[model samples]
Target: MPAASASSARSNSALSGSRCHDRLRTFHERLQSGWRMSAPLELFSYWRSSAAYRVRIGLNIKALAYVTHPVHLVRDGGEQHAAAYAQLNPQQLVPTLRHGAVVVPQSLAILEYLEEAFPDSARLLPAAPFERARVRALAQAIACDVHPLNNLRVMQLLEREWQRDAAQRLHWTQHWMQQGFAALELQLANALHTASFCHGDTPGLADCVLIPQLYNARRFEVDLAPYPTLQRIEQACLALPAFDAARPEMQIDAVV
Candidate 1:
């Protein structure tokens, strides 16, 4: 898909509405009228992208059935650059969610929205405001701190502008992963909130973010020996079907 210009991207919602046949519109109205069945939540995602992985896990936890529209991030210098995808996401980020005419871009916002809009399904965040905030903080620790620093674009910049070799790139990745894990491990190890998962006995939003980031750590051969708490929690998470289903290698578009 060619990247859509910002103007075109903004029009995706309207365009989607126009493209919907009468039955589709009726179907959506039925959904809006509080029909409980899963709607066709079209997710534009790259299998290996951790931000995208977060949303995948959320969807699985909510038990929502959605079609995966794989957006190859590395192919042809990024299919996200294509006009079609850019139209769906003006920012050209992966893991954009399409619910009827609504196009949600940010992963965290998408997760929260799904939890709110589909409350009967397994809740991702806690009901208490403070607890929700804490879960969001823990999730942001990984999403905002560890992730953005080592994202593909940042790594690309290191190689392009700083002339970093593969070894340098791996070092860069591991440095950030270890730094974040060090803090997270201690935090989780001490916090009474930590049960088998990050938030409580049941897996929540924090665990969703942590597990994927840890997956990335292992992917780059980042040493996990320093983060025993993270490892223990991750092992518990992997035992669940939801987390296992959301693994990158299990995605429909996962590269073999």
Candidate 2:
């Protein structure tokens, strides 16, 4: 190789390394400064969506500022099905989170990401491994085992494909919620770890997941008298400013 070419190659490599170093430094500075990025976080949400509701609570608890891009689920046969939004989230689900170049779908994943990305901020998981697993089990019980059965898409499918009426839909939602809440009530009522919230005194992942499902249960007129423990925790959570502010009615896109 020519002497001049080798020198040019060395200079280019040095410049690339310097650029990478600068990028990392900037990112570190942003993380240390409470994630106050120039781009800001963006959330694709539907106001009444339980999944979106959970993410809102997590964001509020973390005290993170974010921009809400409302995706109306009903109007014009569901705006989430539109090409542009579909490209952002192939699942066409509400509560897709965009953080700069990183786009995260699913509410639980978003909550976990926030906990990891901003460790200096409020934590959504406990420090103990066993406690963390307990919290996650409770969260998944609602988010995975229960909420999916009663979400809008499932209701739509029942109506459109199975020709189920509103009364039938209500029964469907109520049955699943009752089963889930019954189990949750038993766990919380017996567990020594349960405190003011699901896992401890502070509201964490389980609380964030639980409150939204309770809201849905109320919306569908499910009987809550059986789950006194859940109701008590719900009251404790709603009294907090973070959970209060994240209510579906308080959202900017809420309908009357």
lDDT of model number 2: 0.94
lDDT of 1 by residue, 3-106 (tens): 56766876986787677776698888777846435457889999999999999889999999998999998899999999998888999989899987778998
The model with the greatest lDDT is 2
Q: In candidate 2, how many Å is residue 225 off?
A: 0.4
TM-scores, all models, native as reference: 0.86, 0.87
**Model 2, span 187-242: residue lDDT tens:** 99968999899988999999999999999999999999999999999999999999
TM-score between model 2 and native? 0.87
**Candidate 2: which stretches are off by over 4 Å?**
1-36
lDDT of each: 0.89, 0.94
- Alpha carbon deviation, residue 104, candidate 2 (Å): 0.3
